[model samples]
Target: MPYQWPTLTNWLEQIAQPFYQQGYVILEQAIPADLCWALYQDVQHQQLTAAGVGRQGQHQLNQQVRRDHTAWLNQNNPVQQQYLQQMAQLQQDMNRRCFLGLIDFEAHYARYQQGDFYQKHLDAFVGRSNRVLSTVCYLNTLEQGGELLIYNEQDQLISRVQPNAGTLVIFESCRFPHEVLPATTTRYSIAGWFRQNSSIQGRIDPPQ
Candidate 1:
């Protein structure tokens, strides 16, 4: 017998209530172990570049703020496609259950080497961005370090998440301020955002 992966329905059912009540949710073993393993393998061969802060023209490297390498996820790779498909299903579910009006999702593979960290930051600002929900899926486990710290509106810590394989974290992009703590060992994860189309005057507000 082969290992059975959880269905999209299962994930949808698990996500709704907690997310509605708290604006965020963390799920352990959210993805299939085999799929995570495959993605991790794919990441090893990717040409990762130093991640930047801010968007488009404002984007620039700032090692003081973050020190991770990243590569955007695309459909051409079968492994990445599988993960994207899962996220697509999640986007539909979020729209139906929460009326989020999500139009699409974008993601990237992030690699955090030892001592790498990302300072606290919000994924989006109200009325300034189209990103509605942010998601993080861990592809590799870490015994220590690389914990994700999520803060509430009062700037108080609410959750400390360990970077465990197959764990998924989803939160309202503009409501939470979060950061990645330095890792004692290498860490791997996928960070993604669900967006609502905010086109104006026949132009994409934020070009993909």
Candidate 2:
């Protein structure tokens, strides 16, 4: 049977506590193993495009700064749709507890080849970007490196998250400056963001 989500039973309370206190939460193996494996299979077969930075019109691919291939999750994929549905539930629960006003979500599969690393950067810029929360779910395990290093306001390192398969990491988009350390092996994961509804003049905040 396909495992249904929101199965943490007390997920709302569990996710809310840490998020409210620290503006972040990590849920381990939150999605079923079968789903994770299925998504991994899709990534193995899909043709990922060069990952870029910035918005739609201003996007750029700077290999010196970051090197990763990405493939956007498509709803036509049953596994992806299942994951999205669970995330939708999580969005609702988060809004209820944190009053985040999250309108929707967007995610993509990211593959970081060996030696590929992302320089320190913030996912959101408070009044500038609409992305409120950032999420990364590891799709494969690594023996060494490819760890996520999160920094604080004083430029001090706070946490080092290992890229363990089935591990889920969530954090505030604007508060943390994070980077991916070069790995000895390829790293696979799903990167996503929860956004608030901030539209004006008929243009969406992110515009896709």
Candidate 3:
């Protein structure tokens, strides 16, 4: 069965609690399980290598794609397009509520299988305004491991997000540092950044 989105206002209220208290929130069963699998299949078909060293000191394989209003609308698949639209709305709503101006979404795929995990690190680049929110939609759940570990400023474990397909987890882009535990099974997710300004896409600014 497809997961129905809560009333926009209701979801907003519910999400805000976690956002402020824990620095992250997870919407369980946010997406349809079947659709999640289909999307994962599509990503596998697209199959890009997990190149590049992440600041977290771990390797990651991702496919980053840029899409705006019109371009995303032209996509052929209804389900896929709906997903994108919802994501767009999510970004817009968050921006407005946070008193941040218009922002862009940088879409991408993140896959971690057995032996693959990302080290703990913040999402925002040093000087870039491109990452304001860290949003991840899980495509498939793992039977074991692959939980997202979030730590406090003192480097103490604060909270852990277990791998659950169809779940959407949101958090501040740079505030919380997190990492993925080694996956016992394959974990698929659509991970992306929501920025405050669309003018400059990626890349954070350097420290002064």
Which candidate number has the best lDDT? 1
RMSD of each: 2.3, 2.9, 6.8
Task: Tell me the tens digit of each residue's lDDT in model 1 across 13-80.
Answer: 79978999999999888888788888988899999999999889899999999999999999999999
| Candidate lDDT (C-alpha), each | 0.91, 0.83, 0.65
Q: Per-residue lDDT tens digits of candidate 2, residues 1-208? A: 3323443556556778898998777777666777777777778888899888888888899888789889888789888898788789889999987899988799999999989899899998877888889999888878888999989878899889988777788899989999999977989999999998666864658633
Candidate rank order under TM-score: 1, 2, 3
Summarize candidate 3's per-residue lDDT along 125-208 as a digit string, tens digits. 545435777887887767788888887778898778888877888887777788877778777777766666434355443210
Lowest summed lDDT across 10 adjacent residues in model 2 is found at 1-10
Q: What is the lDDT of residue 67 in candidate 1?
A: 99
Question: How many clashing pairs per prediction, in order?
Answer: 0, 0, 5
Off by over 4 Å in 3: 1-13, 54-80, 125-129, 198-208
TM-score for all models, in order of appearance: 0.94, 0.91, 0.74
Q: How good is model 1 by TM-score?
A: 0.94
Clashes of 2: 0
Would you give me the overall lDDT of model 3?
0.65
Candidate 2's C-alpha lDDT?
A: 0.83
